[model samples]
Target: MTTTTTLEPVRGPFVWRGDQLSGTDEWIFRLSGDQIAELEDAGRRFVADDPDLRFVTAAEYPLPVCADAVRVFGADLDSGRGFVLIRGLRMDGYDDTLAAAIFYLLALHLGEPMRQNLLGDVLDHIVGVSDKKYLEGGLPSRTRDKLPFHSDSSDAVALMCLRPPASGGLSSLVSGATVYNEVLARRPDLAPLLLEPWHYDWRRQDPNAPADTYTSPIVSWTQGTFSMYAGGDMIESAHRYPGVPPLTAARKELLALVEEITYEPGVALDMDFQPGDIQWLLNYAALHSRTAFVNGPDRAHQRHLLRVWLRRDVDRPLVPRFGKHVVVAAPDARQVGPGDDTGRFRIADAATIRERWGD
Candidate 1:
């Protein structure tokens, strides 16, 4: 972890307030009819072969018509707004497998998909299996609790809506650069602290992970490029482990202030996800969260989203300490659990997550 002493204010398109975007729908990219048709054709062809998703390439599942759309989405992530919402996939026609195939195929065009769990699941299902809070031992994505704004462990993240929750469950994003600028404006003292290394619990990432805790600065600035990796919940939890340093009062204040600014008026951009909507976010550029949600009575009608983490082919670089969880490359080829398990393609329930990767 090379030390960066400068705490200069960040600039560029990534530093944008949500208020300025309210009058516009520019952040959203509605798929044209041709794009949807190309995707459906590609999805059906790929699924028919029963190909391993981990090894699939954009070339194998070509998106000739939507290639330009893919490039713009990728550009928005790395250079422009740091997020994009793509609407217009008609969910009624897609079965679970076809939906997964289309989502995975789109992800391949933007970046290389990475495993999200010990099961080497390149695609993961985000569904609430229990009502417990993450702090109360439930997996964050597997619970109905409200998640605080935080960065995921990846260069880019994509979530395709399979079913929106019956009520609530609004998705929100705050620009990491915007948050940083605001923090600097308010508390110049605390801004510098964000550039210092902080401990994060690694155990929650995977049961088979090699380490217990990892260290990284909340924000990284290298040669005028700005990026951030933050999860205050994980940082606080890491302190519970032996040998990890405890957070000082100043550090705690800094974390709390950061969260406070995220919720300030005109700061966070919130979205109501519809079925077939896909959201692409550059993790380092934005911190994302979800409101608590309700579900239908049965499993089939419940809220579900397919999520994939990707390592994009972008020029942005960060501090060396940033990646303890994000996989920059695909791991060695491996099989999922026993033959009965389908957790790799889609995690149907929390029991499968726990059984495949211990909590």
Candidate 2:
């Protein structure tokens, strides 16, 4: 495989701390009462014009935006610094339908690429709940728990905060390119391991499907840009095969190095989320984590966020190991249900996913 020496650098606005990163109170689009009404009305029009467009569908699909909205969202911002957190929206008064609708519209107007099968594809949404097992497995909660740096599957992932944990749950972000560059400068020998293919546990896949594992690289450069999807557990799991070295000492070291640099204040950013505030990031360009949080007494008010993966229209080529295209099976071929075969799965179909939500 050919590797390009010049990779576009990863860049972001804030730095990461142990449980918090520097963040701006400024919002990309702060809607006033009139602006909110106009936005809601525009959202309704967009949805009505396209009946198939649901909250989850909008997360997966891209809708044409008027030049005005794009300008308001500042689409011209650097791709590496794609994260924008909108503040001052209220979720308490809105029903699930309206809440989802607003988030979908905001995501569409942002125009970031959807990585997962969002619109025309299947499974457009993912709801993260606080579970003991899942939390232990590295999913973020509201309780100020430290999350390891990792990338989700998509060009961008947007999380709409419906509720915040009573304490903690601060959001953190780090640039993958920044870490890679640090490694290259400090430990050049480990840099190449990041470019090699490693296996990942397909957490979203069918349980019975051959262990639901796929292999890809931690870092890949296509054309002049960089793309990364890294996780510790997933890479370690690749050892299930014979003849595979024990996590490749270099890989482990590289992961450690990347994590160290990412946790630094110069490279990471932290922000506290409010209800109705949405945080969106360019997944390929950056890595993000969340602090563990403590939820409220009422389960309904527990920390809740909606996730949508997007594939954007860009000139970047697919990395060989990362596998650029979305893979789908016939609906009939797989069991269609509210949850995965494991019974804990949450389907992303826009129209029916909310019904399947446990809380």
Candidate 3:
């Protein structure tokens, strides 16, 4: 795990400042009518089959008309920028099941959908069940708190907005490459610490997970390639577990500095989630966060977004143990269906959540 801390600035299409991108629509891909029609037609047929979504492959749900658009999205995530927003799907006539089907269909074209929870659910509902904070042992996705910029565990993560909040749930993205450049410019000495291993709370991901803590460097530079996995919150939480090493004062300062840079005017690009809008981001290239929001009276009116984590066929080069054990796929990995009992395949109600998380 030892390597020289190369201080040369990482220059690439991925190294972009958010302020510079405010005037550009290049990061957005609005679906054409024909493509929407193709999705609608395929969505209806796929829903009719009622196939287990876990088993559905890209070949099973070919996006002949929209495949090229998806490819462009992958390229944007991997080579151009770190993220892309797909717009132009009207959800007025469709229900949640149909929306989930369409979202999953698009995800299939992007990559192989991975399980998001111990329940082996490929599709995750990002709805606030409570106003709890991550430090309070609550899942960030299930809480209505402002989340710090961080990368999810997978090659890419996608979210489709099913419902927007009444107010304030703006999503923000920061380029890891940009953050690195800033760090090197401001704190070259501490930049190398980011390449050193840091512990993360594995139990926070799943109480029943095999281990309590897992370790990985925040940034990985291999063969001149740069990538990052920002989890400052998780690293902070890991210290609460026994046997996890405590963060030094210098390390703490470095973590705070990294977070501070992410919020700088030009470092973060913010967006409002709209129904049918999908955001796809590469975990290694960028980190993302959300502003706290207010929810409506009941479940029907609550802010809801469907999320999927995907493992692309074409993997990025990373240092050894960079993100090892981050995402524990279903035991079967490829085949998850009803009755196997890995975990719920759909959104769990309050009771179900309480049963599993004891929150």
Candidate 4:
């Protein structure tokens, strides 16, 4: 990231502790009865015309009550604490078509959709897709393996719970600013290193991209905003390529410290997901992780999640390196669904789903 003469102090709420957020209702935005009714009624109307359920602009689905809620949530994610959990949508036994439409339309109140991958997939699933048998820096969501804490390649990321595992699917999130402060005070030498740019491999994910790799600082600061871009798996994968610089022993020690503090008590807020719960996190200010879990009997009982990547085009100013592999979907692009493989876009379709996640 390019440096600037003026540095901005981290905001107060951005310095939150896991206990503080986890124990309080302040961080949660539960839907009220009226709000829920309004959402379902609108969804019923949408179902009549948008049978295909294509991605619609916010104007296409207005939520008068939800508008203020979405705006406040966006402000909290963008400028306040970097995350929020919305509970109580009650998706059980409803019309599947209308249910999905409601979820999509309600989330639009957060922001316009951002492309999640090079193939222009705005929607993603979080299961163990990155099987432990094969290790790669890219596409961690594919394997059921435990993902290291890291920031995704988006302005904001939203994950909705459709199912939970029998055990061990806990999630942890920490403020990037807190980590920065800790490093600055304890390991000043490492602080400078974090700002330096470095490479991360991409062969395991988007093999068709312009190059097999991309570079960015493990921790970057631009336009007075602090963002972390570190992912252990990807960083290690970059070392496999001959062109990437080898991580020095000292740097290795520094990275170890970072990993340690990421999950250190009181630093990261850990929360278990509830069915119909939606977590919206600011990609720039948060680093998150998930614990490994065993799959249940079959796909029917497997842990499942629906994820959406969002972009408020102008709200967050990022470093130039972040723009390197950014891919925008065509305005004409439509949303793809489970089992629907029109090849309209490269997505997690029925065939690939069974093949990768298991039959």
Winning candidate number (TM-score): 3
C-alpha positional error of residue 242 in candidate 1 after TM-score superposition, expressed in Å: 1.3
Candidate 1 lDDT score relative to the true structure:
0.79
Question: What's the candidate order when arranged by decreasing TM-score?
Answer: 3, 1, 4, 2
State each candidate's clash count: 0, 26, 1, 9
lDDT of 1 by residue, 229-269 (tens): 88888898889988987888888988898889888989988
- Cα lDDT of model 2 by residue, 320-349, tens digit: 657322232223211332233233122223
Model 3 per-residue lDDT tens digits across residues 1-359: 12336678899998988888878888889999999999988888877777766566779878889989988998998888879999999799877777777888888888888777656667777877765675686777788788888888888899989888878899999999899888889888788898889998788777786788889999898887899998788899889988887888878988999999999887898888888999999889999999988888865567888888888767578888886455534454446533246554432221033323424
Judging by TM-score, tell me the better candidate of 2 and 3: 3
Which order, best to worst by lDDT?
A: 3, 1, 4, 2
For model 2, the superposed segments whose C-alpha errors exceed 4 Å read 1-28, 32-34, 43-50, 53-67, 71-80, 90-92, 109-131, 135-146, 203-212, 241-245, 299-301, 323-359
Tell me the spans in candidate 3 whose CA falls farther than 4 Å from its real position: 1-5, 298-301, 324-339, 342-359
Off by over 4 Å in 1: 1-6, 298-301, 325-359
- Scanning candidate 4 in windows of ten residues, the lowest lDDT window is 343-352
Question: Mind sharing the TM-score for model 2?
Answer: 0.73
Candidate 2: RMSD to truth: 6.1
Model 4, runs deviating above 4 Å = 1-11, 51-55, 117-120, 128-139, 298-300, 323-325, 328-359
Expressed as tens digits, the lDDT of each residue in 109-160 for candidate 4 is 7766654544445555677544553244335665566668887766678887
